[model samples]
Target: MQPTEGERRTRLTIGVVAARSGRLAKLGDPLTFVTEHLRRRLRHVVGQGGRYELELVSRDSRSDPEVARRVTEELIRHERADIIVTLAGTRVLPAVADVCEALATPCVTSAFPWQVHYFGRGATRTRPFSWTYHFCWGLDDIAAVFAEMWAVLGAERRVGCLWNDGPQGNWSRHRERGFLPAAAARGHFLVDPGGYREPATAFDDHITAFRDADVEIITSAATGADLARFRHQAARRGLRPRLITCSRWLAYPVDGTGADDPAEAKVASLVYWTPRHPYRSSFDGMPAADLAAAYERATGRQWLQPLGLAHALFEVAVHALATADDPTQARAVAAAIGRTRLETVAGPLDWTTGPVPNVATVRLAGGQWKRGTRHPHELAVVSNSHCPGLRLEADLEFLH
Candidate 1:
C-alpha cells in the first residue's frame, strides 16, 4: 500500500531504551503507558516541509549495561532512529547515552540525577556533550530536600550515609557537588559508613557503625532489595533509626514487589513527580493530578513517580521533532531539542538555563510512604524546601 502522489509524508523514528526486564523493569512500566498514549494522540506531526509520520521504537535494556549498549546500537544502525530517549538511572541511561554520543544521535534522558548523568559519564565542562542532553534533579537538590525533612522532624542532625560503591555512591559522598557538601552546608552531620556493593544481603557492618554513631536518620540510594535487607537487619539488631530516608527505590512500589509490603511504611524518599504537582502536560493540557488518575484507572496500579517523567520525555521529544527545521535531519532535530523551553507534565524544562550545558536540573520534594485508602502505600509530599512551588501534602513521619 503506497501513499498517493498527493499524500507524501516523511517518517521520523524515535527510539526508546528502557530497562523493561530484570530488577529495574518496573521503571519501564510508566514509559510503556506514555508511549501507548502518545501513539494514539500523535500519529503524525506537522513539521517544516509536510506532515511527518512518527514511529516510536522501543528496546528493552534488560537493566544490563551491555544489553543497553547492544539495543541502542541496533536501534541506530538497524532501526535508523533519529533520536533516543530513556528514563533509566545510572545502570542503563549512561550506556544508552554513550552509544548515542558515539553515533551522533540526539538523546534525552531523565530519572537519574543530572550530576551522575554528566560527570559520571566522564563529561567535562570544556567538553560538554552535544548529542546527549539530560533533565533531572541533582544530588544537591535531593540533599537539601532530605535535610529539610530532617529539620521538619526536629530530629538530630546525625545522618547515617548508605550508598553503593557505584557512580551514584561516589557522587553521593564526593567532597564537592555531593550530598556531603550539601549536608554540611545545611548543618547536618552525616556518619559515613563507607560504600557497599549492590545485592549486599548483609548490613551488619554498616548497621554497627550507624548504631555506634547514634544516628537518627538513614539516607541511602540503595536498591530496593538491599534497602529492605538493611532495614530488616537493622531492626533485628535493635538499631532503629528515627527515619529511613532513601532515594530512587521508593519512587516505585516497595522493593518493586508491590505496594502492600509493610516494610515501606513511613519510609521517606525524594518526590520527583506526583499528582500534587501544579504543572500540566503541554500535549493535552492535562493536569498532573488528572494524568495520574488516568494512569491509575487504566492500569489498576498506584501512580508511580516516573509516570510524569515518562510523559514529559515524549512531550519534549515530540516538540523537538515538530519544531525542527527538517525532521529528517538529525542535527536540526537535535538543535530544536537543545533549544527546548516548554512546560511539561513534570514541570517547566528549559535546556538553555542549565546548571551546566547539556543538563537542566529539576526540583525535588520529600515524600513519605504511609497507609492509604486508595492503595496499600501512598507517597505524601512531606517536605518542599527544594521545590517550594510544590505543595506539601503531609508532615514528615519517622520510621521508628
Candidate 2:
C-alpha cells in the first residue's frame, strides 16, 4: 500500500547474521555481499516510492551458535527489526531460527538443508511452529545428484559414507533421515562405518573398514579442513575409491600448489548454484553467469555458492514486504512470506506447495572438478537429473 502525502515513510529493517570473520574466512563473507547487493536493489525500490526504505542490520556470527542466537535476540529486541535473515550452515542458521520462533518474529534463513533443522530438532510429520522460513538443497537433492552421477560413471555401486559430525554427515549416517531413504529411492545402498569428528590426524580405521567392505565410492559432507586432512590420510593409507563425490570440501578453493594427489583430479561434488544453470536474479534480471561475473569483478575473491542462496533470502523478504498489506505488522509480513512462490536467482521457490511447511528447495545438479582446457582447473556440470535443461560440460571420471 502506498502512503498518502502526509503519511510517514515506513522503515524496514532486515537483520542479517553470518560468519563474517574467523576460521571460516576462507568461505568468504556471503551475507555481507548479499546485504550489499540487496541494499542496491532496495535503494532503487525505495526511490520508486518514499513510503518504505530498508535498513539492514548485519551481525557477525563468528561461526558460533551462541553468537548467532545472541545476535538474533538483539535484532528482535533492541533493533526492533521488522524482519530477520541468517546465512550459514547448520551451526548458525538453526540457532537463529530458533530465536525467531521464540520471539514470534518473521525470519528467513539459508545455506543449510531443511532436513538438518527438521530432523536435528526431532520434528515429526506434524508441522511445528511457523515463524521462520528456510530454503536450500535437502539431502534428497544431494542423494539424487550423487546417485545420478554414479549411474553416469557406470562403475561398481558400493558406496562408502565418509561421514563427519556435520548435519549432512549426521543425516547420511542415520537410517530415519533423508540421505539413506533418498539413496534407496535412487536404487543405491550405502556402506556406513560410523561417524567421525573433524580435525583428526588420521583416518586409518575408517579407510581400512571401507576398503574391507569393498567400497568403490566415497561420499561425504565434511568441513574443508577435515576433508583435506582425510585426503592426505587416504593417500597415506592406500584407500583408493573409484569415485569420490563430496560436498563442502570442494565448495571453496584449496591452495593446491602441489599438495593434491593425482586421486584428487576427478573429484565430483554437489553444485547447487552453478552459473551454467538457467537461473535469473529477481533484482536486475541478471542470469546466474552474469551475476557470478559481477560478483567476481566487484570482489577479487571467487564467488561463493552461498551468494546465490543468500540472494534468494532477500527475494523472499522483498516479496513478503510487497505482498503484505501492512509490512510493518510482523504477523502480516510472516503470513505473506509463508505464501511466497517467486523465481529467484537460485531458481523457482514455492514455499506454499512445500514438501514441508515453511520450506522450499531449489533442485541441484552434479559437477566435477576436471583439468580445464580453458583455465587451470574448473568444475564442469555433469549431471542434470534434478535441474533439467542445465547443460552438462563433461563426463564423470573416476577420481582414484
Candidate 3:
C-alpha cells in the first residue's frame, strides 16, 4: 500500500567538492564546521506540504583539477547527488563547474572572483551557463577598493605589480578593463612586470625593474606559495615596499600567514566577508559575529573569512531546495537557484541582478593584517569605499 500524504518523504543529496588536502587545504577548513552545523538544521525541511530529508556527501579535490573532475563525476553518478556545492579558487572550482555543466547537475560556489569563473570557463554573453552559478566580487571591485586603500595611506603613485599567468592574472592585467584602469583613475601608476607562468622560482628581473622605477606600493593576485616566494626574494634584494597588497591572500589561513604570524603584519588584501559584516544567516538567523565566534571556540583557531563564505554557500543550497516544489528534479532545483534572492551571512545574493546571467557580485572592502589583542594576527578593515556600510576598523598602516 502507498504511504499516506503526511508520511510521504523526499531525500535530497548534496555533494561537496572542496580542496581538503593539498596546497589549498586551508580553503576547505570551514566545510567541516559548516556541514556539522547544518546536519541538524537540515535533518528535515518542510515544504510542498511534505517533509524532505537532506544528506550531504563530501569529496576532497586534493587541489588538483583532474581530481576535482573525477570526484564530481562519482558524486553525480554513484552518490546520486541532487545538487553540488564547491568553495575554491580558479583552479579547482572551474573544474567542478565544467563537470556539473556537462552532466546537467546544479552547482553553486564562491571564494574566487566571478570573472575567473565566468570568463575562464569560456562563457560569453551569447553563450551562458545553465548548471553552474557563482557569487563573489569581481576584479573591478578589487581595483576600486585597493586604490582607495592606497590613497588613504598617502603612498607614492608608483605601484609595482606581480600577476601570474593564471585566469586571475590575465584578467587583472587587462589594460582597458583590468585593475590598471581603475587605479589610473585614482592617479596611481602600475609598474607591471607582466604575466609569468607558475612554479617560477626567481623574480630577480622583476625586483630590479621595481627598484629601478622606485615603486613604493606592490600588488598581485598570485597564489599563496608564489606570493611567499616573491616576498622572500624581494626582501633579500632589499626591495621592501611601504605597502604590499595581495588579492586572494587574506581569504584563508595559509601557512606562514594569517592569525599565527606576526611577520604578516600590515599586509593587505580585498575583503569579501568578515565577522563584522552586518548580516545574519538565513538558516538559523545567527548573526555573522556569533557564527564566527562559535567557529573560533569550537576549532580553537582564528576565524578565517572562508567560514562565512562556506556557510553562505549552504544557505543558498538549502534555500534552493526549500523553494523547489519537486526537490528531486534537477531542472526545478536549478530554476530555484537561478531565482535565489535571499539575505545570507555573506550578505544578500540575487542571481537575477548580476552583471552576468550566471554570476552575482558581492560587496568588497580593503583590509590589512594587524597584530590583534585577541588573536596572534587579525584582519582589520582599512578602507570601505566600495562598501560604505562596512565600518572601517583602522587606517591603512605602512610597512615601513
Regions more than 4 Å wrong, model 3: 1-9, 153-156, 253-265
Residue 133 lDDT (model 2): 84
lDDT of 1 by residue, 1-400 (tens): 3346776447888899877788667888899888877777888878889887888989999889899999999999998888899988677789999999999999999988888889888888788898999999999888888888888667448889999899899999999878889887988889887889877978888999998988888889987678778877888899888877888666775533443253344678888788888899998799999988988888998888999999999888889989999877789988998888999989989988888888877778888877677776678878776675888788776654
The digit string of per-residue lDDT tens for model 2 on 1-400 reads 4457877656777888867887654443766776886676685224223457677888887878898899889988888777888776557778888899889999988767678876676565585557888887788778878888777656337788878766667877667666877776667768887778765667777888887887778888876566677777876778767777886655554445354632254678877886666888877788888777777877776666777887788878877877776777788888888888899888999988877878888788888876655345667788876787788787888753
Report the number of the highest-TM-score candidate.
1
Clashing pairs in 3: none
Better of 2 and 3 by TM-score: 3
lDDT top scorer: 1
The lDDT of model 3 is 0.83
| lDDT for each candidate structure | 0.84, 0.75, 0.83
What value of lDDT does candidate 1 attain over all alpha carbons?
0.84
**Which runs in model 1 stand beyond 4 Å of their true positions?**
1-9, 153-156, 255-265
TM-score per model over all chains:
0.93, 0.91, 0.92
Scanning candidate 1 in windows of ten residues, the lowest lDDT window is 255-264
* TM-score quality measure for candidate 3: 0.92
Error of 1 at 283 (Å): 1.1
Error of 3 at 8 (Å): 7.9
